[model samples]
Target: MSDTLLTDLHVKYIQNLGKNKDDLTYHMTAHLRMNAVYWGLTALCVMKHKDALDAEETIEYVMSCWDDEAGGFGAHPGHDAHILSTLSAVQVLAIHEALARIDVTRVVNFILGLQHPSGVFAGDQFGETDTRFLYCAVSALSLLGAIDRLDRERTVTYLASCRNFDGGFGRVAGAESHAAQVWVCTAALAILDRLDVIDVPTLGWWLAERQLPNGGLNGRPEKLEDVCYSYWVLSSMAILNKLTWIDSAALTRFILSAQDSEDGGISDRPGDMVDVFHTLFGVAGLSLLGYPGLDDLDPVYCMPASLIERMGLKKGWKALPRRL
Candidate 1:
């Protein structure tokens, strides 16, 4: 109820997410099952309680979602493999140090196979392309240490085409700039060491403007603030080394105010229903803002900073100093 993170309650909340399988909401979200696991697991890690979820059981569930026929992961058992779910599967395995359980070579090939001639990636065999899928592919390959197999120049060229005059990026070439799209393109460039392609000051200014008078951030101009943008906007700013451009204290308060005091999660905005996605992004934003009693998040990869550093993929992105 206070203006502070409900750490224990959130950990318990995440712990219970997979227990109610018989609930209608659980079946309704089968398409997001893998992603929901990733979000819950990562949120627990940020809370410094990765053990809250049993590693063995978690790994088993993740492996069950594997589409052996496609060599990638599906959102849930019996679903089609997708780049988005594939990335989530990879992230969950990496966090639990269980990547060895899957065929890295096959997964890498599956991801590489999704790249279009234009260099963007599709979500799956359906062929819907977007910068988000590109990031998922890039991030997954990087985690598997197969990034060298990707066409770096072509990827960069496609990202460059998506850039807008306002210094932000869109889902595709010539589309209007959006915060979420900017994050994927910017983060993918960071993974490729291609930040040089971005107009730093111009993009930084555009990102800073996402923070509104309410202290929360909107995906774009004329949009209402959402907790998820806490990650999209702040992570991009941290990567750009422009974190100070926004009001950290105000943003922190805004995120905390959106907490589900009784139920133990965070929502898009204050008084909204809480879910794992917004909860992770909200807490991650606080960590980036230097809130006390939290772990550092690698803005570039959206993973634990120490884990990324241990793997030698840590970027030069900045986060506010953690309060003692």
Candidate 2:
């Protein structure tokens, strides 16, 4: 399960954007906006391979995605500002140690503006609310050292309402449980020191059930496996203090098999396209499994060594108890 291939592919993604190009402005197409996830992935990969990246230039590109008008960021220039992208943008900048380049006060205000009266967060000004946006809201605030900007009590109550009868979390209240949403909601609670509010054991059991015979994890019961869920489910279980409940060895095999040896990244499945999104998560999954080549990732934030240090938050298994 050596990740040489995966790292190489990620480097290629970074390279494809061209040298000295602003990542925030470099979109695959003119109509498609630069996305926060892309910048986040770029920042993570840059941190992972600092010696290999033009760090300062890359950070500048990530910062360009910030949309000062709407009090949040967009995926790229000309895109609507959104909580999800704003979170990624802030986290990426933090990871790059470039938080100084951002207007912290305005960014904080932007995140605060997205919070509705009910404690639910809209993804953007359009009022599309979801648990995913809630995760972004919390995570962005955490990265900014601005968690105080959020109404913690109301936010936690809203997150609790998204919990489904299946013991997993959903995108919104009364929606069906989903693995990605479960990760977002669980991580939000962990970051807020409210993990005990959920039925940990039941959620852990449901996450464990997502594992397929092929060694990959799926989003929900009976769904096909995807590489992205490897991070979603594994990180959630890790935050819950229940990684032992899942088959780590089998999942590792599936993740490694998805690597495109020639291209240098892992795909969603064994023969699929390799992209930055899966590349970061693939490494994150390996880190969760205690893979030798990588360092331990924060189960809640999914950030790397440097950015976590910059935040100076509590770390390791002990931090888990504090959340409880």
Candidate 3:
């Protein structure tokens, strides 16, 4: 296992992802093409290599995903508009400083229209409500400078309902606690400036327990440790100002061990096939862990810290100091 980040290899891997349109995996992931782009781009940004991808072409591809009929973005050209992809579109545009390419008023309305009276948000017209969707809405709106349109009270109440007694959150109200859900709820509250909704001490304790003896994190109890949870878990701790709770050194080593030293991507665990989703989250986790030569990541937005700060969207989270 490599003890250091293979930054150059990972950059090349991301650049090659959208190539070879005939590849089965490429076709299979069409439903998430927009999100895949955001994941790859954000990973590059965290690695201090945003220019690795062509800016104008990438922005144009992001714009092409727009679902004009719905005033939102789809996962790909022909896919229906969904809140998840819409948020990905917004984030990628924000990272590129290209938000002006989108119609803010219509996109804001499309997102607000997804919110039910219950304050929970659906992914798209199909109506599957999740706390994750709620975060996507809040975040997208904030990036567009339209957060004022959100019903703060209702949104916070809905998030409160999703909080488990264990102090972690679930996909929906009354569901079991999972680290991913905890991140959505916590980060949403952080962005909404309503983090008082969380029971900090209890949540901190629960988050700390996610770390296993192997030094990786699992999403929930009894699950195997995975690379994605490194972000889901660490970002939660960072937002809560509790970075000291995790064994950062051990977890960092675990993340580096999962890297594809030969082909350049991160997998769910060691010896698995690497992909963009895990790669972004792994690099993100490393950034929060103060890995050397990496740029700071805004845990709340999962974008570059400098970009988030410049946009006036920085939240109250703190990551470990960048190591030399």
Residues 171-214, candidate 1: write the lDDT tens digits: 98989999999999999999999999999999999988998998
Per-prediction tally of clashes: 0, 5, 0
Question: Candidate 2 residues 1-324, lDDT tens each?
Answer: 343335655666555645435665444542333442443354344336644656676577666766767766677666677776677777667666778888888888877888898889988778999988888888888888888878999999999888887789898899999999999998899889898788987998999999988889999887899998988999888877788887887887888888878756667888887765677677678777776545556767777644576577643421112110
Measured against the true structure, the TM-scores of the candidates, in listed sequence, are: 0.99, 0.88, 0.99
Model 1: CA > 4 A from native: none
Candidate 3: clashing pairs of residues: none
Per-candidate local distance difference test: 0.94, 0.74, 0.95
TM-score, candidate number 1: 0.99
The alpha-carbon lDDT assigned to residue 197 of candidate 1 equals 97
User: Can you tell me which runs of candidate 3 are displaced by over 4 Å?
Assistant: none
Comparison by lDDT, 2 against 3, better one: 3
Native-to-model Cα distance after best TM-score fit, residue 285 in candidate 3, in Å: 0.2
Better of 1 and 3 by lDDT: 3
Task: Give candidate 2's error at residue 160 in angstroms.
Answer: 0.9
